[model samples]
Every structure is written in C-alpha cells, then in structure tokens.
Target: MFRLNRLTDYAVVVMARMANDGCKVRTAPQIAEDTGVPLPTVAKVLNALARDGLIVSQRGASGGYRLGAPPERITVAAIIQALEGPIALTACVDGQSGHCESESLCPMRGNWDRVNNAIRGALEGVTLEDMTAGLFVPMGERRSPAALQQASGK
Candidate 1:
C-alpha cells in the first residue's frame, strides 16, 4: 500500500502545529509535547526538515525553530520530499533503471511518470496552510461558527 511512513506522518503533524503558530520559535521538546510525538522522533524530524530548509533552527535561549517560509507558501510535496525524497511510486518512473531487471523491456515504461506527476501536482497544490485550515484555532480565535455566534449570544 502507498502510505507515508511513521516519521513522515509525524513530520506533517509537527509542521501543521508550527503552521498554526508560525511566529513562535518552537523547540523540539515543545513541539513533541504539543504534537504528542516522541522527543527523539521529533528531533529526527526537525533535523531533516531543517536540512531541507523547511524549518529554520536557531541557537541561544530565545532561539528555536520556525517555518522557513509562510505556511501558505510551503507545499506538502516539499514536506514529503524533505522526509521521504522523491514521490515516484516506482524507481523506473523517472529514467531510473536497474531496480528491476526487465525495466528496459517493460511495456509500461515512462507511463508511471504521468501517474507520479499527477500525485505530485496534487500534493503541490496543497499548502501547509491548506492542510491546517480550520484544523487549529489560535489563542483568541473562535473555535467554530457555532462558537463565534454563541460568544455573540446569538
């Protein structure tokens, strides 16, 4: 089955959490606590994301990590690529060979690229902001429409 690995899943969660509060520089331990992901795993995920320029890490007491760019500008495809590399379903899709002996003889050669590109395009269309829209409410933001109306005594 085509599914994201556990760490990649954690990365998405971590990223979404960061997106909700993009201004604050968050430490891995704080992120782990917030996202319920383990510390070691969060550290691992953070390092990879930093290396890929998805998140920027800093030092000193006030320094931590924050999104490299606005959440709306960062695509899910970039996140997946950061943690898992390319999105190709098969090695032979993008001129890659030697994984399968019959690669050259395969009838469906090159067709997988279309499939891969479609999936990539879909992922690219979804920004981190898109993924977290309405999923998180900040400190003073109303939780939902009902809550907003209720607060107004509607």
Candidate 2:
C-alpha cells in the first residue's frame, strides 16, 4: 500500500493547523498543543517545512512561524514534496539517472512515470484551503448547539 510515513502525516496535520489559524505566527509548542503532535515532532516538521520554504521562521522574542504563501496557493503535492521529497512510487519513475536495478530488462520503466505524474497531478489539484474548508463555520454562520441539534434531527 502506498502510505505516508508518520512524520509526513504529522507534517500535514501541523500544516493544517497552521492553515486553519491563518497567517498568524505560531510557536512550536502552540502548534504541538493545537495539533496534538508531540513537541519534538512538531519542531522537526516545522524545521523541514521552513527549510523547504513552505513556512517562514523568525528568531526573536516575538518570533514564530507562518506560512510562506497563502493557503490557497499551497498544494498538497508541495507539502508532500517538502516533507518526503519527490512523489515517485518507484525508483524507475523518480527521474534520477541510473538508480533502478532493472533498467536493462524492465518493461514497465517508462510506464511508471505516467502513473507517478497522474498521482502528482491529482495531489496538486488539492490545496491547503481545500483541506481545511469545512473545519470551521464563519462567525456569522455559527449556530447554537440546540440549533445544530435541531438541524440534524437530533
């Protein structure tokens, strides 16, 4: 099964928390608390994200981190790339020279590239905004608990 490693999954959770919070700079501890990811893991994910230019870091008394760009401009593919490198399902599709062992006899060598590109394209279509769209209601649209229960036929 194609799956994201734990760190990549944590990174996405951390990023979603940030996107939900908007452009405000958030401390590592705050992010850890908000996302329920461990502080050390949050710090590690933040470092990788900042290094990849996904989030900007500041060093000072009031310093923290914020997204490098708007949520709508950042795609899921970019986040995956930032945390996990390229999204190649196999070595042959990675586009690196001389990395695969079966280059001589592999019939599915170039075919994997097509599959990889399709996956990448699908991920690129989803943005951070898309991921957190239904997480919260606007202030004007919020209803009381009773109203919510009634609306849901509870």
TM, every model: 0.88, 0.86
Compared with the true structure, all predictions reach lDDT values of 0.90, 0.87
Model 1 reaches what TM-score against the true structure?
0.88
Model 2: how far is 61 from its true place, Å?
A: 1.3
lDDT of 2 by residue, 1-154 (tens): 9998899888878888899889899999999888889999999999999999999998899899999999999999999999999998988876655886778787786888899999999999999887776555567899788776666566
Candidate 1, residue 75: lDDT = 96
Residue 97 lDDT (model 2): 51
Tens-digit per-residue lDDT, 1-154, candidate 1: 9998998989999999999987799999999999889999999999999999999999999988999999989999999999999998988878777888888789998899999999999999999987876665665764878775565466
User: Where does candidate 1 have its weakest 10-residue lDDT segment?
Assistant: 133-142
Best of the candidates, lDDT: 1
